[model samples]
Target: MTVLSSSSSRFPYAKGSDGTRRLGYGADYNPEQWPREVWEEDVRLMREAGVNIVSLAIFSWARLQPTAETWEFGWLDDVMDLLHAGGIGVDLATATASPPPWLTAAHPEILPVTASGATVWPGARQHWRPTSPVFRDHALRLVRKLASRYADHPALVAWHVNNELGCHNVYDYSDDAARAFRVWLRRRYEHLDALNHAWATAFWSQRYSDWEQILPPRLAASHPNPTQQLDFKRFSSDALKNHLRAERDILRELTPHTPVTTNFMVMGGTKGMDYADWADEVDFVANDHYVVHGPRDEGARDRDELSFSANLTGALARRRPWFLMEHSTSAVNWQPVNLPKKFGELARDSLLHVAHGADAVCFFQWRQSAAGAEKYHSAMVPHAGADSDVFRSVVELGRTLEALAPLAGSEREPARVAVLFDWDSWWAAEHDSHPTARLDYHTEALAWYAALLRLGVRADVVPAHGTELDGYDLVIAPVLHMVPQTLAKRLTRYVETGGHLVTTYFSGIVDEHDHVWLGGHPGALRELLGIRIEEFGPLADEDTVGVDAGPAGELTGDLWSDRVDVTAPDVEVLARYRTGTYAARPAVTRRAAGRGTAAYVSTRLGVDGLAALLPELLAPAGVTSELPECARGAVEPVVRRDADHRYLFLVNRTDTPVDVPGVEGEVLAGPAVRADGRLSLPPRAVAVLRGPNR
Candidate 1:
């Protein structure tokens, strides 16, 4: 079940083949915004902070071309030369996602049309029509210009196209987009009959007899129709990918050797461009996550701080290291509560990504923001320059990394635990006419992930199709709806061999074709789960039920509750709901198979319930939580080992002191704890604990 055991030192860049230093820093340096004279001082400061890389040309569309049909590269050319002289490599950007304002005005087709029927004007970026041929022609031209200009530059490391795609959701239902979508759909279905079948358009009598009869799913007239909406989402994503594919092809052909990738948005809930598909074309994955110190909803701040970002990046790239493309070094202006990172919090946050598997770490801006939307976001240098406390912290962290290069590229080789998360289930299940709109796939998956994270177990967040169940000792399918048949057979065989399985509600409900697998609930998984879902009880927004006994005790949350009849001979009821007409019904059940067990939870539970359940699951495997009472909002660090050495990651997730046991040296902030055993940690710190293998 072991994946790969390379001497991590050989893979320092996370680019096993690129042979470049993988660990570095990120900053949007618009030297144009700063005087040329300030460039040297900034470079010196960056080098002092252990900064080795810079993502340049972001938001420089206007600077590159102030007017239509004109080009200007004087400022960027100097910036690249200065950074290169300082030993800082650049992630060359195409600046394509955003078009200059004049281009949008000259070609009105570039602007996006909202689902509400209003045409959006230019000012913000990513506002162009993805399918507009004019937009594609114009954008691709600029990408080629940048590629040709910098392709051979010694400072160039990777090619970053645009900044973030789909920053604005949905676009131009103009005649051009409509025309393109018709052709796209025709190509996909080959015939109107097949298209109608996939869309289930037969129910609405919206069948198209001719290819021209199909129109781009727009919000104005045929909007809000679930079938059309889903199609629009799919088409929009494909359209965006087509744009990305065009640029990817250009970069691949021109540069060919240097890796190319774009930063993906955090928790981007299926806007349509499959990152996994994009990952196939690009060399590796890079992502940005900006979680501020504030509450957006009822969820805890820590939820977004660690789990959400981890899940997003983890989902995008499972086997390889993903670059942390951008994060605020201090408070972000966008959040209502712009509280700055308390002492060690930032460093701890950085380590969490590495512990989970980040190849490199960097901040949004090395120097302070001068103007624009992100002007208020914190940076390594405050407007006050080198005198800032934040800058000093950056220096300290840099020194720490300098001391730990010997451990460079080493990864956390974790235990065999696979949690199947799929974007299809996320997109399709939400579009369902189900009884409850609260049945969120990501939330359900996170609930299960949170439980596993607490046990100090390293689990790989993988797609159902990509993972082989035999490689894992435990397979958790959280809210799995669209079960791939090939995946179903693998899971069937795993449980038959007695491997542990923990599944939740709404699993095994649909197949790859988005059709229900009927019999009872869960289709093909019914026999393995050994239960038939008679009915599901939808809990009111404010209502809740508690489970106080079973393998775990005292579980409570407002989730979709269900009633089930156990059919397997070895099944036993572990916990029951404590409310309503269905009170005393089994909420948690476990069944014995050949060499292991299968557990099912019919409703959502609170932290207490998870605390009880995870220990029981890990007990048989002889794994235990190393830091049982990690500081509130702090993530517990996990330690892993091989034949030669033991690796421990001290992930500090809190904005306050998160003291933890056992630390000899760290990649950042040297000698975290003395041998005296007084575990002391700074806020947001990442202490890499290493010692001889036992």
Candidate 2:
């Protein structure tokens, strides 16, 4: 049995040798890839860049254990000792990211199987099956060996269970996965009758008589069972979590003083693992976020999505300081064009994460790799070496972080409005047989966030599960598809107790089991929203709809426009559709319930439309911008509060200089303060201001 540690005790993780807490700054250090002579130079440069910590031996499983019978410790020992001497801490990885070639060769069954039953070979990383006992035993054996060897090493600060748990090999459909899936199902439902009811198996005859008869949602003639696919996703995430626990348990058994964490990829479209559910499993939440290049909007979603993910990560940490495990320093090799970051973007991105409560800001690598699949991936030290622009930016950021060292133990100041994010909704809504197949949960969620940013209103992007909605006056949950009974009641109670809610279309339609609610469309939320719909009117790829809000103005939208009918007498149609079969019908509706109001949007309004609509909703909640009138739309504000003072992070979103007047605070590591008591920021820059918290 695994013993749980008090997460409170692990606060202020990764301290200096003098035991003083400071923001950790470094990257994933793979000194094993470099020669002995290069090792000395690496340490020297790390000190120059103000690097105090690095995640070591992340993908070194093959090197650490050459064969089943052999063990290698001398190289790791030297690297640890060298880092300690260089005044750097190590977040040591378990090296179980991939099995050694010998292990995979001896036991090929350990490899993952696709839904089509094809083997996932070992050319890439994370090829081992999460549920394979053979793989688990060997992995745990290696974990035990490494933990025992480096338990007392001075360089060790934290334990990284695995690298990006479910990046490539999350889903598996082999016999092993089938057996494990069955075990998980039996544990969850406990009875065949309950299982059948939950799965709704009477439709196509997928009901299971025996627990052993059910298999993973593999390739089928038509679309597989929706509930089965949802359960499989849940089971797959759990299986990987189990593997993380296995390695974390060993590390805790040996070194109880050390903290354990796994890097969560909380970026765009990477939705396999539910990080919120796995938050407490670690000592502190650590995330790996990468900005994806956009094609349609010319990368308009890139920065906004980055901020959204970081804010959501902070919410996962419950607003506590967490670790930024990996991000790019410049152009990443994975994208199509691979464009380098624009001037001032490098510091702006890093500081934006810090503003969202990242105490440790690190990247994918310490040095650019000379050879590998990720050789072209940007790093702190690029291929051009220490004299390069990337390294110069690294040094400047290091200096900036040092100046902002007082921000180490601070927590993110709570915003009055919050945008709820749900992995369940993202999973279930986009499942194979969904409406239009063009419904993107992240895109819609980001739309709300980008609107908030454009309005200069600070809104925390928080996970819907286990998060307290009572704290916020206005709660926006976009595309909240999977609403269980408990969640419905909780949201209802929240509104009754004076919390305003704004939800978009296709929300509250399905229960947790993928079964639709028996009532009208927007099923669970229909009564609250005071609007009912019989059917969805999803549009074609080129179709558009005009939403007419009197005096407020007309807005254009696409993708979805539902036929809405007001059910409650008190409900008001805020906007109406001006085009199509539902012409002059309710496009947006609002109803007062108890002490609060509930609002609904019937179409997929892009950023601009959402921005225009948000003002009407926010006006009733009395939400306004903290920024000055001139800097309202162009500046993004994030506040972090310590015991006495608040640190305000102001990020510039434009490409030209912006004058931010009426900012009354002490300037700490950002744009220079002027004699006129105003601050000006260059394009894509960030500024920190300190003031009295009260």
Best by TM-score: 2
- In candidate 2, clashing pairs total 0
Per-residue lDDT over 1-694 for candidate 2, one digit per residue giving the tens place of the 0 to 100 score: 0111225425435355676658889999998888989998999999999998999999898888898988888988999999999988899999999888999999999999998889999988999899999999999999999889899998889999979999999998989999999999989999999989999999888878899889998889999989999999999999999998989999999999889999999999998898888888898889999888788664367888999999998888878889999999998888888888987888999999999999999998899999999999999999999999999999999999888888888889989999999999999999887778999998899999999998899999888878888889899999999998888888999888999999999999999898999879898988888889999999999999998977669998799989998889999888999987789999988898999889999998888888888989887688988888799779899999989999999999888889988777888888877878789988898999999999
Model 1: per-residue Cα lDDT over 28-94, one tens digit each: 6666678778888988888788787788887777789888778998778888888888888888888
- The lDDT values for all models are 0.69, 0.89
Question: Which runs of model 1 end up more than 4 angstroms from their true locations?
Answer: 1-22, 170-174, 220-228, 268-273, 292-308, 311-315, 593-596, 617-623, 626-635, 638-646, 654-673, 676-679, 692-694
> Model 2: clashing residue pairs?
none
Q: Per-prediction TM-score, please?
A: 0.90, 0.98
Query: What are the per-model C-alpha RMSD values against the true structure?
Result: 3.7, 2.4
How far residue 420's Cα lies from its native spot in candidate 1, in Å, is: 2.3
